[model samples]
Target: MLHVISQDLSSFNTLGLRSNASALVRYEHAGQLPALSQLAQTYKKVFVLGGGSNVVLAPDLSALVVKVESRGVRLVAESSDAWLVEAQAGENWHEFVGSCVDKGWLGLENLALIPGTVGAAPVQNIGAYGVELEQRIQSVTAWNLQECRLVEMNAEACRFSYRDSFFKHEPMGRWLITAVRFRLPKAWKAVLGYPDLRQHAILAAAGENATARQVFDAVCEIRRRKLPDPAVLGNAGSFFKNPVVSPARYEALHKAHEQLVAYPQDNGDYKLAAGWLIDQAGWKGRRMGPVGVHDRQALVLVNHGGATAQDIAQLAQTIRVDVAARFDVVLEQEPVAIA
Candidate 1:
């Protein structure tokens, strides 16, 4: 059975933008998805919502909003080499990570404190501290809206990339992720490549010997210092995706601006820091109406209070135009924009 409600979505989205959903449906089990899909057939448009941490809802959403709230986590399989952990779509990402670490599952330690749900992770290919969701993803179970059936997709089939997946592109709205399974290696090793994590590990005197719990704690601390809690201040965490450029382009930028922050990629491209670019454009801590760039981290855009979706869109566009003019690079927004 599907429970539909007409409600204001301001409380649902992290941005806290004023919006209204024509119809909203909440599902607590995978078995309900097929019926929900059938219910969606009655609507002109349908949109699936997760934890609402990575989206900008339009003021008037003339669509059926499906909120996934299915929840559970368990060890599905184990071998001599690895442990297969599975979690339902609606489980809180940070909580799930913490639970895994508590149980001695180590791979998700570096991704601690990331917002949103397990289902949304694969869609965004969420990453932090040199660890990405794709790295641990063994498989995904989803409801295929097009064929009106359930299907499973492996990591490679998801076409994981930098902040993107097949879920975000080709099959976009056709698949509703219900659960995700991760492969945690038995021989756990710390991912200390990220500077912040490395520094924290050193400061804590854990270094290479840091347990999964220590890494999780360090990540939480780092994130707490850098990002404002959405409950206290509205934000979508890293509004813009770091732009990747060719080695030649990076060299040219480096020559012009010696302090330009960038990281060398495995494929020879350079991932320029979007925050540095935004700060260079003089948008950090700057406010335009109800929207502003966060002072501590320029990559974040904050809602002062009572901001409209249009206001946020305008502010983002202005920043984009200015960054392009100054750096000849376009900064793409991380959150999905509903219109």
Candidate 2:
């Protein structure tokens, strides 16, 4: 069964911006997606919404907003080298990762506290603690809205790259991801190369032998200390993506600004820390009207209260302009601005 309601979306989005969708459709089962897609045809536009962690909606959405609420988690298969687990799109991401750790599954520990739903994970190729969702993803099951059929795509077919995927590019909005399948290694090896994780490993005395639970706890602790809780202060985590530049450009910038923070990629490119650039540009903790840059983490944009989407967008633009002027690097927003 599907329920349709006209509602305020301020409570849905993590940023707490006030917005109203013309009509919202809620579906709890993947089987309902086909009907939902058919219903969408009656509207001029349709928008798929998940946990609402990565979107900033306009003042009024004239389209039909489909809220995915399907939920389940189960082991699909076990091979000699790995375990295949599947989770519905609507499952809370952190909770799913925690469940994996509790069940002795190891690969998702590093992505502990990332905010969003499982289905939204592949759309952004969510990454943290040096481990990305793409690394553990085996396949994705989706409802092809365009063709009105169910479809499955292997990880490679997703074309994942640095916070991007085919779902976010060419095939955007044509498919609604119903669930994700992850391949967790049986011979679990901890990923501790990330700086904060390494430091926490030393503090916990786990080092290279850290259990998946320990790593998960450490990652959660680090995230808690750095990012503001949306419950306390409205925010979409890591508001901008780190800018990647050529090695020669990085070298030139390094010589000019000796303290430029960056990490070299395997392809010889360099990912400059967007937070460092924004902070250096003097945007950290700066506020205008009802929105501002987060005090603790410059990468976050916060809505103080009663702020509109335009207020947040303006603040972001100001910061981007300043960062570009200061560092000559362009910062790309991580959140999707729905208009």
lDDT, candidate 1, 76-172, per-residue tens:
9999999999999999999999999889887998899889999999999999988888999999998987668988899999999999998898534
lDDT (Cα, tens digit) per residue for candidate 2, span 57-124:
89999978888888999999999999999999999999999999999877999998888899999999
Q: Give lDDT per model, in order.
A: 0.90, 0.89
For model 2, give the 10-residue run with minimal summed lDDT. 200-209
**Consecutive 10-residue window with the lowest summed lDDT within model 1:** 199-208
Against the true structure, whose lDDT is highest? 1
lDDT computed for candidate 2: 0.89
Q: Using Cα atoms with residue i matched to residue i, what is each candidate's TM-score against the true structure? A: 0.98, 0.98
Clash pairs, model 1 backbone: none
